[model samples]
Target: MLNHYPLWKYIILILVLLLGCLYAIPNLYGEDPAIQVTGTHGRMINEALLIQIKNALTHEAVQSKSIIWQSGEILVRFMNNELQLKAREIIQKVVGQNYIVALNLVPATPHWLSYFAAKPMKLGLDLRGGVHFLIEVDTDLMMDKIQKQNIETLHTYFNKKNMPYVAINTNDQNRIILRFRDESTCKIAYQSLSSYSPDIVIHKNAYNCLTVDISTDKVYKVREDAVKQNIHILRNRVTQLGLADTLVKRQGDNFIIVELPGIQDTARAKEILSATAMLEFRLVHLQSNIYNSIPNDFDIKETPEGQAVILDRKAILTGNHITNSVANMDEYNQPQVNISLDNIGGNIMATFTKSHIGKVIATLLIEYRDSGKKDARGHSLLEKHEEIINIASIQSPFSNSFRVSGINNIKEARQLSLLLRSGALTAPIRITEERIIGPSMAVQNIKKGLDACIWGLVSSIVFMVLRYKIFGLIATCALLANLVLIVSIMSILPGVTLTMPGIAGIVLTLVVAVDANILINERIKEELRNGRFAQQAIYVGYKEAFSSILDANITTLIKVVILYTVGSGSIQGFAITTAIGIATSMFTSMVGTRAMINLIYGRKRIDRLSI
Candidate 1:
């Protein structure tokens, strides 16, 4: 009974090992170089388009390994990267502008394993090799916009409070200038504004002019928030676009670093990642004559169909207040996007609609695009684009939620919904640096790392077998199980990316496991030398070794936790693998080896131990 295990224990161990093997099976199939074709602008992938793509590839004498239509997209696999590249050009020309053809490395997992949602661990950018971008946030523009908004807010506040001010505007230095009739009025206004918020600094000059500026700490906070918001929005955009294994992180005060593993469409990635698109709700100036010179407060804008309309420059609400949006069909079968706003936006919209019943409100879609030109400072210039997407008369006083109709198609509506739901970027961004890692280089790195792990494992197994004989063989089996369990757990967990440093962690973990086995083997030899029976020595050896094994692995886990907490990128990857390895190694080296020893030696009387 000293070395024996219960039936339930054996059953649990068997079940765990079986599940590990089941999940670990997917990694053996590896990946295939492939091309993914997804529709854009509401274009759906139909069988006809699929056939067109196939025919285009065939006409060019590019043989594809397999082509399948799945999840509203077409996946074309190739035996090598050469065919994949050739097929991409052909597919792009065939699909035209309505579709996006992107190079990808898709999993070659079998259908059986996929049915259970078993997948291999995700590879990092260094191993899978896709695209990396360093983007700079336009903090200058963000500050300017914030200042303008603050100026408008102050103007509204002064008007509502009946303050005596001659003019309120921003000057060339980006400071809000408020002119009062006298120095006394300026002092009074300054006190009122200062009491409203501690974030602003107000100065009164001798000429009855007051300078309103943001505090230094507030300015720093605003810039930091803009960069952080952009990082969140970029992550949402990439995820919605179905780019797997994507990473978006802040690099510095005004920069973000994005890594897209297994995605090769740099242009598409750039277009989505840097887009600063938003919607605005503005009142149309129906009384203004479009044929004449427009008023200074109003601007002439156009619809997508080229119809001109006059609109107020100031917006009642912007997309920043939008909390949720969804695309749906109206009673007339027209495409529309239903939008929800936050509390402040809801109150503002309610007040505006209640007074301006029957007035025409327009939904304006604004986008900032690269103008194909650089500024004097060598930065790409952005051209602002505005179009009136929808216009409708107020049917009632609605707040919080509303729908915008007049969309061109379902695709456009869905796209608009996606952008709104993902939240708008606080500032524009430009890609300052870009690097692409080809599939060949990624494969080379993966092969080298894998080779190192495999060789390390084999060497450990040989040493254990030669030193401890049959008991060493038992330890080798546990080691193999530990490896399988680690792979299976990594596969099951989400967002675990395997990197070279992660492989190093796995190697170190194997060494730790071997050390544990050596400790147990040496203890058993000591017990045998003291004239103990084989089975009793085995029991005593394992009993005394558990505490040491637990202590050592717990210490390792403490370091892994610290590394994970303070690290980023590759260091975090290493910590993840080490943590997982420490856990599995503890189990296999002690509980697992004990279970096997119990089955082989627990039931029989022996004169001497093999170890």
Candidate 2:
């Protein structure tokens, strides 16, 4: 009875190991180098498209493992990475611009195991081929834009206060220059605007002008906000694109690091990540004369056909308030964008449309792009481009839901919908550095890491068996079980990316496991030397060594927690696996070894132990 376990204890142990082995089996099946082809806009993958792809690959003399159409997408698995790359190029040329071809990795898990939701653990960009981008945010331009907005705010404020001014504009030096009618008016306006906020520096200048500039503190705050907001929006876009195991994090004050672990197409990732596009709804000034000067609070926008139209500068709704958007066809089979707004946006639209039911409303697309040229100050120049995407007369008062026509094709509609749904970036971002890891390079990294882990585990097992005899054998079994449990947990958990450093964690965990068993084995030997029988020594060894094991593992877990909280990218990946492995090692070293020891020695009386 000294080392005996209850029936339920054995049953629980057996169940846990069974489940661990069951889930761990998926990793052995490995993955396939595959290409995923999905239709763009409203294009749908059909039987005809599948046949077209098959013929293209055949003509290119590229051998494929299988080409199947599933879930409205075409998946072609190849025997190797070279063939997969070849097929992708051929298929892209065949499908034209209507479809998007992307490189992917699909699990070769059996159907029965997949039904149970078992999957292999995800590999990081180092172990898996993917793309990494170092993006820099244009915080200077963002500050400039903010200053222009402040100019508008000042215009409204002065109009309300009945203050007369010739013009309120931003100078080349990025200072707000407010020109007044006379010297007396300039002095009065400066006195009134200087006390507006502590964040602005307002002073009088020559020629009856007043200059306003943002304080240093305000500039820093705006830059911080711009970086944080861009990170959040980039995450939303990656999610909308349906990428898994991706990382988006801030590197410095104005840099963002994005790692797409399973995406190899840099063009698509860059296009989605760097796009600063938004939609604005403005009323078209149909009564204005094109030859005359533009009205106050109005601007001119050109359509695709080179026709200019006057539009209100003030927007009734922007894409920031859009809750959802979908690309679909109208009753006439024409492509259109269906949009939904939040409660506040819906209320604003309801109020605006009720009073002007017959007025023409225009959907304006505003984009800020890099001009590929820098100013004298070494800041990149940004070009603001506006286009009138849609023009329609409001037939009735509508709230929450509406549709926009005048889209050129389904592709345009889909792109607009994706941008609106994912929200807009607060500032422009440019990819400063880009690196692509091909599948072959990933395979090499995987081989090296796997070799390190395998060698470490084998060395640990051999050392334990040589020193402690049968007790060492029991520890070896527990160590193997610990490995299986670690793999199973990583597979089942979401967002666990295995990197090279993560594999190191696994090797370190095995050493910790061996150390734990050695402690117990030495404790048993000491107990036996103190005139104790085999059963009593075994029982006392486990009971006394538990506190030491728990203490050591607790300290390790504390360090792992700190690493995870403060680290990013590959450091976080390392922390994640180490934490999981530490936990699993504790379980296997204590409970698992004890259970096995009980089965072999707890059945009958023994005078001496195998050790």
Candidate 3:
């Protein structure tokens, strides 16, 4: 009974292996060239849309393997890349600009395996051919925007507190100036504002004004938060495009690196990633006098129909309050936008509409665009544009749900809706650098990596079998199990992308695993040579060799953890795959091999064993 395992242990081991094999089945199905379509606004990917897509494809005589909707996007799988390319152009025209149609490669997983949510390991940007964008956040512009918001907040706070002040404004030097009647009032205002806004530096000037500037620490904090928030928003936007494996992380203090895998449309990715779509609903004011001056609390804008309109500066509702929006047609067959608001936004709209029935309300779309120049400190120059997309009069009061008509066409309506659904960015982002990976290069890299893995595995197997004989064959079996378990774990786990470096890690893992088996085999042979019984040698060899195996694997695991924590993109992928492989090898070498050894040699006592 020296190396014997219980019946339950055998059952558990078998179950684990079976589960791993089951999960690994998806990887065998391969992938198909596909086109993904995502509606910009709130276009639903339901059966009706599927029928329309099918009809359009049939009309164009584009043959496809299957069409399925998943995660708010429609995927049309084709037999070959040629058909995929042809279908993309035809579908884009059929769907119009309201939807984003992009080229992709989707897993052709079987229905039985897919029912368990088993998916193949995602390929990284380098492996799947995608776009890489180095986006720089305009920290200077963020600081300015924060300062202006603070100035406005101060104005509101003073008005509410009945504090006497002549004017509150922001200067070119990023200082908020509060003009007061006298020094006594300025001193009081400084004390109050300083307490209210602790992050800002409040100073009483000689001109009876209080100058407020953000502290250095606060500025740095704001920039850091902006970059982090932009990363989160970019991830959400990318997911909305139906992309699976995307990398969005901070590259430096102000730059982000976005790796979108299997996305061939660089222009579309750039547009979606860099868009800052902010919406506002304001009361419109019509003026007859050409030279009429507008108040400080209002702005002048032009509608899409070439009509000039004046709107309030403060919005009754903004995109932040929008819960949902979709593009559809009105009763007269004209395109319109249907919007759903949150509770607070609903209340505000209801109150406004109740009081201002028959009054025109303007829907303003604010977007930020790069100015094609860098500023003095090497930050990108950005310009903000506010356009009135819709000007409609309220016929009745409503809450939560409402519709805006007068959209020029269905395409525009869809684009507006998509922007609303994607949400707005807190700050502007500009692509400082971009790179496209072609499909041919990706395929070649994958082939080379596969070749390396195959050769490494074969070499390991042949050496083990030739040297250790039967025991070597047992070790090889365990190694194969380790590989299967590693891939299965990665496939089952969400967000694990396999890259070329990751493949290298797998090869390295196989080398380490083989070394472990060799160590154990040599230890057993040494024990047998010392005149020990076969059972005793097997027990002693495994018990003693475990210490060395644990030490080696633990140290390597520590290094892998460091790499994972400090590295980015492909480096992280390598770390992840290596870590998982190390863990699986530990299980297979000690548990898996020991189980097989027990079944083979633990049944009866033996004086001599094959070495």
Q: Top model by TM-score, which number?
A: 1
Error of model 1, residue 295, in angstroms:
5.3
- Candidate 1: C-alpha lDDT: 0.86
Candidate 1 error regions (>4 Å): 153-172, 176-198, 202-211, 283-312, 329-335, 354-362, 370-380, 387-396, 406-411
How many residue pairs clash in all the candidates, one count each?
Answer: 1, 0, 3
lDDT of 2 by residue, 1-611 (tens): 89988989989999999999999999988789898888643356779889988987888789898888876788899887788778878998988876778888888888899788988899989888889989888887778887988898899999999999998888878999999999998888888887898888998889999889999999999899889988888888787777888889999789999988777787656655654466788998888455387767888898755689888889988877888999899999988888899999999999999999888988777766668888786666767778876677787888899887767677567766877787767777766678999777888999998898788888988988988999999999999999999999999999888999899888888888888999999999999999999999999999999999899989998998999999877888888889999989999999999999999999788999887
Per-residue CA lDDT of model 1 for 51-161, tens digit only, reads 998888889999988999986789999988889888888888898876888888988898888788999889988888889999888888888988888988897898899
C-alpha RMSD for every candidate: 3.5, 4.0, 5.8
lDDT by residue for model 3 (1-611), tens = 79899999999999999999988888877788888887653344556777788888899899999998876678899998889998998888778776778887778898888678888888888888889989988777778888888877887899898999999887879788889998888888887877786688888788998889898899889888888877877887777655678888888799999988887778667666755566788998766663277779888898654678888888888887878889899999988888898999899888888998878888888877778888887766778777786777787897899888767667667767766766666677778888998677888998999899889889988988888888898999999999899889999888899999999999989888988898899999999999999999999999999999999999999999999999878899999999999999999999999999999999797887666
TM-score of 2: 0.87
- Which structure is stronger by lDDT: 2 or 3? 2
lDDT of 2: 0.85
Q: Is candidate 2 or candidate 3 better by TM-score?
A: 2
Error of 2 at 445 (Å): 2.3
Better model by TM-score, 1 or 3?
Answer: 1
Q: Cα deviation of 30 in candidate 1 (Å)?
A: 1.8
| lDDT (Cα, 0-100) at 39 in candidate 2 | 64
Top-down TM-score ranking: 1, 2, 3
Measure candidate 3: CA RMSD. Answer: 5.8
Q: Which predicted model would earn the best lDDT? A: 1
Tell me the lDDT of model 2 at 190.
86
